[model samples]
Target: MKKCRSLCMLFFVSFSLWNCEPDHKKYNLETSALLALTSTTSVPPGSSFKLPDANQTICYDTSGVTRACIGTGEDGEFTNTPAPFLLQIQDSGETILEESSELTWQRCPFGMVWTGSTCIGSSLNVYWQVANAYCNSLTTAGRNWRLPTAREASLLADHSQNTFLPNTYFPNGQGAGGWTSTPAVGFFGRYLVSSGGNVTPIDETTNFPFRCVSGPKAPNASFTDIGDGTIEEANTGLLIKKCAYGQADDSSCTGSASPLNWQQALDYCNNLNFASRTDWRLPSIRESYFISEPSIGNSNLPISIFPNSSQAAISWTGTTYNSTLSTAHAQMVYQMYVYSKTDSANVRARCVAGP
Candidate 1:
């Protein structure tokens, strides 16, 4: 009877222990299965899931890992965190994703090797002519490629990166200099670079390297005669003085504007009231380029609208030329090129109003 009682007690203890085991393990298994099903059913491949906020911008890391709310804190404040799923990065063709601009760029810059997502090769340090030729010859992604404009080349400047460029996308690119399609003063070409952390231009020659970009060109500029000794470029929305400063004539500038130093020219435009408007200032290199009609010989400007435009005249731009605070950039409208001139050097000024 005692032996039977002991056996029964042992069985009872074993049964109690078995029943006492925690139920959490089974619950966890069930929860995991439900999550898997929900994920599969809710999110489709190549589809995006919204972040916590609708305004939050999505960003990606160098390894193609995606994250959310990685903006520069310009549009309000927010916290950044890694996204749940990796983005599908495609590197199969002549184009790859340019994360910064979110545009697809060519896998290589003309003569470089496309290594998966990035281009890897030394850039050819060629002249403006050669650079343009190389870019024109390129046939990538079934499209013709051409050299980037100054504005387009400026987009590649990434101050956050060590080389001031997105090296991951433009590997082996020269950070100091790259040629732009925009012409500088004289026979030079405009090149974009961050010299001393400032976007500045240098004379384009056979010494500089260039990168090609593929995009729609800016639309042709249209002119409207304001009839108040000024004309408005319809495309750029800039009000240009009909005649150069100091050569003010309703019909045409009989003489060239008196060449003043950079500072003098700036002050002249700022103080002088024109066209019943007080806000007159120097045009930027870009702004000056906008008015330039390279097809027109001699004056390189629309002669009928802007009469007496001189090819020999070099106009001072508001932009500084280099790291030197004392120098400024000037544009030669006739040749469509840029060159650096001292602040004290005598240069012409054509005032512009509005952007």
Candidate 2:
């Protein structure tokens, strides 16, 4: 009977210990899982769980690998974190974005009138005020503006089109004969007005008109005469004057005039006695008229040639008055009436030749 009682007690103790072992192991496993779950981004399989502690973020995923770290809520809860995002930028390389919106005012060359991108008008006319006002009222790109500098003004005159105005704008138009930005000093033999930075008398207030232009700054030089290795100014261009002998006006005589009778003057010319060149000739009545000097009443010389050694004086032509005495001469002088009477002996003579 004693042996049986001892065996029963030992069996009871072994059964109790075996049952407690499983509970202890499960508790340890649960603790380990909770520690990992504190990250707020992982989950354990087949387990009902909460945040490790009130401050724990409780990152949880379906498989515990796909992570989403987020801040913990007041009750240790978490909101869904937004997905990742990206940004993009645009690029603009080396090109100017032109504003081709509408018509506006623009300045043309000094002597030109603006008609869109083209400039037109006589090279002799178009003074400053007219030009400025016209430019101010001229419309391009939706604005009115004054003409550009000599350089900027020339862009409108396209020699390739042979047009002062583009053919597209003026189909029946002649060669492009508009204002330019080039100054007269460079190739036009520098004018008096140009020296003072003023417009020519031909472009007087009552004579010339204005054109408008506006756009990019006018360049330094406008039209280039590739043919003659020259550049035409925006205002004057190559139209101002034509080249002749070294002489300008009628007074351009290479040799001193000798007081002579009609026969003597003729003989002198035939001899090529003047300027070493043999092609000397007695000018026609019309040609001689340009050399005639107006009577300034002997007051100081006119400002035209004052201070300059080149004094202008009237000269006689070789033209004959009639079949009268073989030596009768018809002298051509400036500012004289064609029907007026005049003495022949008092007339002065200047000789001219061509190169």
Candidate 3:
């Protein structure tokens, strides 16, 4: 029955089930099930998700270093020249509305109630189940609310540095980490920890701090094959290369995905010219994190969207936070990870264009 409703939604139709909202203050188990139990999505396709800048200002070299962003093609080099994540604080000041994704986020983390002036109270640490139960029952200005997915969870964190901090729009600081709805290997679910923590996959039964977000859920996988080796993602307006590094896009991306060091991977995308677009570059950490899949164990990315994918689908991002830390986003094997820039690790490169 849930599957049928999902298919109907894919064809531009949406379904509402058990919508006996006579009690707005209480959590409707049936209506809440539509968000938590059945599908990991709250909104249908065409609802956009925006990628905010990492807000990195200073550049870094391969070794112990601090530098400027004049020439280096790192994330710091393009710190909001044009495209930027626009967050609008609602009139109540308790909720925030992100312009690009159009999702309203609760200002406070779970367990901390919004007291108009600010969020007060200690954060509640509970299992994923408890977290969702709280989200369902709590009534804040009355909007459909649920736990954030991996992509939405990633956006709420402060990724400017390797450590976790308050989001620019978040008046109250975030907790250590939280449970995301996106499931990972086995019973483990994706935990959106600090930028350094890299969305660690852990047992979902464990207790952790979580935040609630209401409004449309970001699409799990929404892309249109542009027919010329590129697929344009409707949500972020990002054009990603269909093939991995070293694979030829001859209809089906053939051959093995090449493994290149961090520097080599950066160079590959920096100099890439395909589909008549020369603006291609190594994707930023946020951008790479955006192309995520919920079933991220064997391969989280949708096979129908990114077919013939490399078995080991780890790809480098241009996010170099400090001298030692950079990012590598994956669709098949690993989650978002931070690695030593000068390490001998060799990863693949999947380039992207647009903001």
Per-residue CA lDDT of candidate 2, range 61-158, in tens?
A: 21222133332111112121110111111111101111221111222323334443444553334333333334445333454354433222212232
Off by over 4 Å in 1: 1-108, 114-119, 125-144, 148-208, 309-312, 334-345
| TM-score ranking from best candidate downward | 3, 1, 2
Q: At residue 96, give the lDDT of candidate 2.
A: 12
Work out the TM-score per prediction.
0.55, 0.23, 0.77
Instruction: Give candidate 1's whole-model lDDT.
Output: 0.49
Candidate 2 — what's its lDDT? 0.28
Clashing pairs in 1: 184-337, 184-338, 185-332, 185-337, 185-338
Over 243-317, each residue of candidate 1 has an lDDT whose tens digit, in order, gives 886785668777767777665676677676888987677765445655655434446467888877562377776
Stretches off by above 4 angstroms in model 2 are: 1-127, 171-203, 219-355
For model 1, the run of ten residues with the poorest summed lDDT: 74-83
Which parts of model 3 have CA positions greater than 4 angstroms off? 1-39, 42-49, 80-83, 113-120, 167-173, 188-197, 304-312, 322-334
Maximum-TM-score candidate: 3
lDDT of each: 0.49, 0.28, 0.63
Candidate 2, position 276, lDDT = 36
- Per-candidate clash tally: 5, 40, 0
